[model samples]
Target: MESAVLTQALMRPAAYPHPVSKVTLIETHISQVFLAGAFAYKVRKPVRLAYVNFASLATRHADCEAELRLNRRMAAALYLEVVPIIAGPGPLDVRIGGNGAALEYAVKMRRFRQRDLFSTMAEADQLTGAQIDTLGRQIAAFHESAPVTGHASGHGTPARIAEVMEAALNGVAELASSTEMTGRVAALLRTRAGSLQPAFHKRLASGHIRECHGDLHLGNVALIGQKPTPFDCLEFDEALRWIDTISDTAFLFMDLLHSGRQELAYGLLNAYLECTGDYAGLVVLPFYTAMRAVVRARVLLERAHQRSAAGAITTAEMATTQMRCNDLLDVACFALTRRPGAITIMHGLSGSGKSTVAQRLALAGAMVCVRSDVERQRPPHGHTAGGGDLYAAAQTARVYRRLRAVCCLGSGAGFPMIADATFLARGHRQQFASLAARRVVSFSIVDCNADLATLRERIAARTGQGRDPSDASLQVLALQQRAQEPLGSDEWRHVVRVGEPAAVE
Candidate 1:
């Protein structure tokens, strides 16, 4: 880290547009920032690090130029340009034109108010739901339009991430001795690494990696004209910048949850999934989130050791970072334990609109809709009381078994279940109710009621259109009415009149 050259470089008049009455130097682990009036300039230290390399003066200048170029993709108004400083050595005492040869380059940027950063906004409680949603849309659009890279180049694959994690841990180990907590953390990382291998291999084969914002989190986001915008993407390493889109977005999601905004985290995730139709990517979220948290923890730990005299964060802040890291690790472990199994039963007679309602609910969450009508309509599975009919028996058994299986799976995975079915017969209703009761899980039976004429007309229209699963005619509807059993006063059965809002009781 040679500061004499940089100090002289900063003294040149070409570095500043206005008179430099004073120059404030800010140093971080990787770079030195110079704050001048109305502008800030960053100069990468000529230091080679394991995760990032800025070893040579030429490489540092090239990286500074690359940073300006890449960041302009998202923040054109902020990244002014990279300017070369012409200087002559004299203990760094020089002015804009006061005698100097070409020395070095610096990334000049428009200085934004500290309050514009999301971290500051969050501290002030100014980060709102609308802003989160806006960020979701922005990131979604960014991912949609970002360049796609070849399988070998994309940095999002599991193997690549594992390598990064290993490198990061190596760096941490180099900085500190092995302790009980570090040992546990290392073990957990190994387990997560193992779990992601298969999935990572699949992505590698499928070429799911693309160019992404390598570093995305609250601090990198800012409000310009009251609009949340993402900026400061990592431009130093092409390997770090190209990654799985989910891996890119996971950092923000983890940060949100860590900030005590779990609901917003969930909302942002759902929104992104909906926009991108990357539901399958959900499986990899917890792993990426934990990795991001650990990375932040490592950075904060380093910061605790090197904080400036007056601006250093308190001891409590360091402890909080440790706690947050532990919490994130726990979340990652919990997610690994979850196995997807979900079932929704659509229960309602012909013309009751139970299928319609079930379809709507299914769109909001991850659940498989099992329709009795569809099951019954399968070839020989049609309504017939004949014990010899194997297809009929199998389909009936499958309908019941599928419902039960889904309920068990959803309960175990901690997901909400919506069982849609027509509970006309007491025995049929009891079967599901009993299963739910045994699991101590919530159940809602939507017993739909409508005017007889209206029901008959709806059934006729459905039959004429050939779109409805139920083949029941008017006569069958009459039979259904005669056989219908009233639901007893219970917490689970929710009897609602057709076209009316649902009542929980």
Candidate 2:
């Protein structure tokens, strides 16, 4: 359709009640988009394909309406109702004539500033860690509220995964042959496909499938008044929309890594896991992320092909694309096979830098630190006791029990658990060692010791900063010193004198 015709169609009362003096056509390969006033309208091109079909005006209208309905689930306030435009005798007529003949349908939406998108924010380093945590919680809640279908939806099944893989391989092969994605990339794609087929089937049987946002990426997310909101869901195909939940999340994770936000990527993944409690899904993430990356690579290659004659798909550009594909495939391989494990326990008196060290180690992905100070402060029987009532043996036993349980669980899940506690006695260390032995995992304990003056200074500084959780007064520290026992020869223990960096190292 001509730009004028499309503009006129958008101006119809059925499309937009308000007057629009000017309209801008945003041309995309798959759809004809128009920006009218404060609203954006999208109309699919008249084409029939294997994955999507909009061959007729009626089908396009129905799809438009479908898109409006589905996207409203996430962006309800943004996706306005769809409107039908009728064509008459005039070439660009939008009003109804003798018979109201439908000309086209437009998917209307609230216009958002392009610069407010997550992709732009990430490029500017404005997508903070806190924002990513919020995004994780929001997406977790969305997935929980999303509708779940039966087996007939063709989701979470071996056949469905096979179909998706076959389609992706076919698309990649066609793009590679027509474009310049040859040599290492072509070989890597084949190798990844072969390695992933078996795991795909296993995941299908494990009921890891759900209806998901098929095309989740940075561009599809926008920050509206500082909150990340996802929009423009893929409504053209049910098969594409219904997929493994991990596969859905992997798209954004891969996109983040591709955009050079590995820290945020890891944080997002960790936040999502903490929220959804889906640790089992981690095993399938690599394969899903790899597939998502290759899908994008293939789409980029196809775009390159369309501009081949314009020198856009040059030999050098093709090589860059190949390198990206290889990198993604390598990440997938490493994610699937490499199982990282390490345990670093922090033992010290109150205000000895255990929490600070634990925080740094956790952020570095070195260990999952469990802080006893934090755990002990938790309710039921925390630090409310006076001198006579404080340090109850039963309370100490309960804290140790909780610590051992968390350590065992983390170790069993393939992540070394770092237990941060005041190991004042040999019994305390022995309890953790027993638990590690039961799980067939190794444990390392680092004893942190500081002078009385240094400990007092650190404790005062922590209190000034409002970060310390301990109630260790000078009297409590003196009591702790008297109660503490020296460590004997133990292979797992290492003594580190705090505030003396050279000696510790």
Candidate 3:
């Protein structure tokens, strides 16, 4: 049977055994999704693309099974099963999910509301930081538990990653005459990808590579049961799915930034780092971010070309898609452009609003903030080497050292960073100053201050809320006050003050 005939049958509401008044058939370049009342059935197109080949019945079935198995890893409740599309004896009598020799295979999923999708929320200006925050934590947990690759898979190696990036770049570039993803954008992406091979290999060696949700854009996520549930992972390509966790994160981050939600991007990145403590990813994130943008641009460009060739898209629609693709390319170029780096270290008591200032800088995309309290709590995943003495003098010194290393790495990569901690001692402050000098980046000490009563009240409220990672107590604040050393004249020269209306800038 022809593929279009089967899809036409599935589009009929009567073809479904379940009670449905209408069937909405949404078509993509690779798949046809029939949204029945309570369920949706997806059938892959039997076409060979540069990246994916679903030309044969067997291959389509295998890809369907792969999609079902992999999507169930994170979204168990949404993906129900893979069902066979059977044809009855009568002519033009195709039935959905029945017992017979199958003509096609379909992935059956429980239908979810369109309004709950992250893309929908973002389009309506309803997406929130809290939602992105929750999304970050959930994705972190998922990545930590996802299976690691063996030596033979050859999935996460720099060669394989570059292969995929180059393919995506070329695919988008082929459609460049009709698309706005021009030759210049492709050249920039190629140059940046080539330069970041060492960083990619480093992440792979450090076990940052694993099976990830390769397609982690907003449209693939939904707020199911008040949780940001990710579904529809990339199943056609192993190299795309098996990658550095930061690469997976960079997709959604790029999507948010492209959608003009910078604060949500910062919240998402910060929240994920808080959970996983993978601050080192900050250096190579721009490269990964550009790659993701190219990937997205490929999707848009390819889809527009395919539809135009099929006579399924109007000229106006194709022009609109081209503009969107150009916008994504612009974002790709901007992400790769490096700005002058700087360091901002917080100096204040526990409740003196130091963390607040750090958060503001991060939200503005001015810097990546690393908090001491969060780092002190995580001790090598399972070793627990320093878990028993979080506040011991040696432990504190170790935390400062680690913070300086991360700051230097980020600054060296042309990204500003902030170390969120009470720099009460002169020695701790000097280490960061030395790092800034070595990196040739400007350094500022943000001295956050508030009245004593306000400080105590804020700490009390934070303790009651219990959502903050900080475990600072009243006693800790007392100790911070007594241990605080007055900044010398030299130290005062590099000071930036906060906690005042006009001082933040």
Separately for all candidates shown, the number of backbone clashes (residues 3 or more apart, or on different chains) is 16, 0, 0
Candidate 1, 1-505: lDDT as tens digits = 1465666557454457675666677666677777777777887776665667777778888898899988888888889988765544455543332344535567888878878998788778788767887887788888888877775553666667878888766655544333454556667777877876887776556555777888898889999888887887888888778877877888888787677766566556645754554544655666677677667666655655556344677768756756655565555555445544333344456677776676445444534344556544433323554344323446556655655654564455444455555657667667766766676665556556556777788889889999766776888778778877766776234443445523210
Query: What C-alpha lDDT do the candidate models reach, one value each?
Result: 0.66, 0.68, 0.85
- C-alpha TM-score for every candidate: 0.66, 0.70, 0.94
What lDDT score is found at residue 14 in candidate 3?
Answer: 78
Error of 1 at 428 (Å): 16
> Where does candidate 3 stray beyond 4 Å?
178-181, 380-382, 385-387, 464-466, 500-505
| Leading candidate by TM-score | 3
Top-scoring candidate (lDDT): 3
The C-alpha local distance difference test score for the whole of candidate 2 amounts to 0.68
> How much is the lDDT of residue 309 in candidate 3?
89
TM-score of 1: 0.66
In model 3, the Cα lDDT at residue 401 comes to 86
How does model 3 fare in lDDT?
0.85
